[model samples]
Target: MAIRLDFQTEKKQGSLLITEESESNKTDVIRGFFSLFGFEKEPMQTTVYSPEIVVHSQGKAEEIQKQVSEAINQRLQQLESRPSKDEVEIKKPELINSKRTLNPTIGEMIGGAPQQEAPPEEPEWYQTGIKNKEGVPHYKLRYWCKNPQCRDRSNDYIKEDQKTVKCRKCGQKLLVRQAADEHMKRDEWGNFFIADKLAP
Candidate 1:
């Protein structure tokens, strides 16, 4: 029934002419060039091909002269660049050891070269008894697991007989003593706040 399109893209004065380059079958010439223009829409990018769909052709451009002679013999066999064995030119080896990481391709089982991330641990201030008024024992903070870049743990303690003051690492309600015997400030959520002027 003489259809059309097998490979196309022509902008002559601006440079994008591919008209059927013998792609042998660039996947059924990109599914018969989008089913000969009803635009089955699959291929993408030459900036999404639209300067009037590469200069008009609602059909009958000699019904794709055999997909334009197999896309002009596949663009003269890709302009005679002839080198492919999958064009052997691979070379990605320049990491000088500054801690080269990125371990992602989970397939052919080639793991084991990225186990060096253990250097960020300095925040464990425990002491939530909360007693701030010139008696010598303070630390009133509670609940700060919001995770601002992690690594803080004031889970605090000291409820021996004050009755209700939790936050042993995010339980939230703390402040069993606050007259300010003074000394404990981890704020911004990690909780623990008794700076009675840094009392003694």
Candidate 2:
């Protein structure tokens, strides 16, 4: 008996040819191979086939041939059940909009363009006209939240003795500095002028 395996793919196609010398010889070889691979309980008694066994053999070779044919047919059915290259549909990948932002917006869901947000205002100093015992002027700082995710921006009234201040909403540290009134010349109302400097 002869067996042939034909396989085809999208890029390549091939055929495999398998032949047996004789029915009895092929049966012995198949039994030996299966036993060698632990597929059978009995091991091959002799590596070489004897004339006596061949002459004495009645219907054993035919039985083994039938089993081998059934196994090959079952395997071919399994291969045929799989999706073939020609039967399978190839889909093109979806095009991603790189310009689109990761943050989902109401406008995006409604099929409208999203509105751009105004840039945050930078921190600025404001004098409160309050002075400590040492005559150092106190100032309030209006700053934006340092946290990228936080939008809470407000003024924090820092005490004269307080060295550090943080955002009340996000707990992010605020950069604060005392007004150097002693080092600057002030007008009659006691407001320090940035352009005027005191004598060394």
Candidate 3:
């Protein structure tokens, strides 16, 4: 039986339509062709607007049509060459009865039994210091007022020189120091002065 194939090659609205003399009987074959060519399984009904196949480009439409024609020709040739149903003998598939054995799991292969977990080690001295929730250590230097009367103390993260800090009681500018032992020379006026140390 002859098959009629229609195609629309418009840039925006392109489609290919396939119609056979016995399309109702050859539904499976048509579905297979659509699947083989990566087309939608649902067939578009013949109408004033809709076409059989909708392609993205003109080249694709033409290529699909050519392929479909070739496939149909091949199918027809195969059908013609095949023996009649009465003359052909069908063999039933033989059933094999076998037990499916699963391979040994990783634990089974290693020791066969679950081992007890060891206790976690204690944290080191440095690790146990002042740290954030994420276990990151924060080292803050101590900053205190030099005035004995106003023995106010504060903690800061930065280590810059001459960092001015206001005392709560005296409200005087207190210079920051890395260590308590940092020497400060006293002038004749009794004012303490820090000598500038040159880089060696």
Candidate 4:
């Protein structure tokens, strides 16, 4: 059986017509050809006309129609070269064990398995709380000499109040009252510790 196909190209659109033939099944062949070249197939029939399949093409009609015609000719040649169903032999595929195959279960294939999560990070020692020599949590109090010209204005951590507080650099006397005014304050992260209040 032979199949007859016709096509026309216009300015903005292109169309293909498959003439009806009772000897062969042209619908499948036309559909496959249209799909291979990205064309849309539409069914059309009228009382006065024979049944036919129509496919519309987009883009440059001349170029698209030429390509579609070439593809259809090639497909028809291939179909002609293929052996008839009665002259061909069929073989069943060999079966393998489920374990040997890498096919995972539906649950695993769809990402249903729980993955190992990373451990939660621990806060740094300084951030948790300031510790004394005995490993007990304590507030850190800092003081500095008030004499501006003494060059001993650097801060010193005073853990306890003593009768005499003096700057180690210049032997200048430091008052506990002034130390209270220069106490270091820290934020939740403990990154910034400054006098009076936490750094902005």
Candidate 5:
């Protein structure tokens, strides 16, 4: 392929200076001028330049340079022109919409909290209390050792019974204890009778 030749002249210090050369014979001219211009500080940084091309049979090299000279001059205009930074305005960040409330219900306040059930109450008929006669402070169940903790069927024995109540058949001396619930009922020959232990 044939090489295209071009020349770049920078407009600085009121006069135009050659910064590029497409002709091989013009190296010394470009280097000396570039050395004075401080090539390191200049905006022109291209090390590789377009080679000066020679046409076969007709036309001068100076005339050949005209076509490519426009391209080099255009590049110099671009570098010399004041390059300004483009201002890109960033969109302000928006606050996310979170759920907030003024007054919340009990369900909302404890929505994620663990639930606890109340302890069960002891039944009146199933609970019986026997006191200590020896001046002990704490009260405990009297006939709790028997199969039926209450004195309804088996022996009536409080923990601190002073005297033993004798059994008629077995002669087993037993302790006398109070009935639970206090509404005691006795049965005699198919007849039912209510005892007054429940009276206030």
Candidate 6:
């Protein structure tokens, strides 16, 4: 007669080992044997069910057992040497800013220095008193560029039809001063204020 033997293996200390094996005379043995023994084993690894191995004598059974054991042990050793999912370490890629530079070249260092701009000049307004044809009092506001570096610094008058005015030569914005009356006196800063009345 012939016999079949089924075995299950387990992993321990990062290695696979056959901890349990059972024999069946003719039929397949259910893997529930390990559960009855109070613990569950790993999945079934190797099964030895060769029809050539006959048990006519006890010596033949011993030989069959030796051959099956060697086959199962060799397969287990192969599985053990391989790395498991938990044993592998997954490395993530590092992030970096595209515009940032670690080192500056000679050309970049020379051009990178920030240039300072010249401070703006204060505006000056010139007012001229005049009267309308109906004798209703009015005044004309005038201004010109005073920037020493501009060609328009000596330009006495700039005529414009629009209310908002800028220097024609230098393009700098000009301020305007309006007097409430001809008697309104102007300070050095172009601001108008009523002066105290003087005795005749």
Best candidate according to TM-score: 2
* Model 2 lDDT, residue 188, Cα: 47
> Of the pair 3 and 4, which is ahead by TM-score?
4
Q: What local lDDT does model 2 show for residue 79?
A: 76
Q: What TM-score would every model get versus the actual structure?
A: 0.18, 0.27, 0.20, 0.22, 0.18, 0.21
Q: What local lDDT does model 5 show for residue 106?
A: 72
Clashing pairs in 5: 22-52
8-48 in candidate 1: lDDT tens per residue? 34622122234444545444654444555444544332221
Best by lDDT: 2
Ten residues in a row with the worst lDDT in model 5? 190-199
Residues 15-48 of candidate 2 have per-residue lDDT tens digits of 4334865766666655544443443644222221
lDDT for position 47 in model 6: 41
Sort order, lDDT high to low: 2, 4, 3, 6, 1, 5
Q: Write the per-residue lDDT of candidate 5 for residues 149-192, one digit (tens) a residue.
A: 33333323233333344333344344444334342322232111
How far residue 42's Cα lies from its native spot in candidate 3, in Å, is 24
What does candidate 4's lDDT look like per residue over 1-200, in tens digits?
A: 23333433342223344554531344465555555455555432111111232334444433343444555566678779999999899997767652465767777889877788998776454443344657644443343455666544443333443334566666666444322234444544342222322112
Task: Indicate the worst ten consecutive residues by lDDT in candidate 6.
Answer: 191-200
> Which pairs, if any, clash in model 4?
none
RMSD of 3: 20.8
Instruction: Give the TM-score comparing model 4 with the true structure, all chains together.
Output: 0.22
Model 2 residue 170 lDDT score: 64
Taking the tens digit of each residue's C-alpha lDDT, what string does model 6 give over 1-200? 22354434454212122324544421122333334333344332344543333222122333445665555566567779989999989997767644566788576688974667887664333334332435544333345455556636322222223233455676665554332445344445443321121212
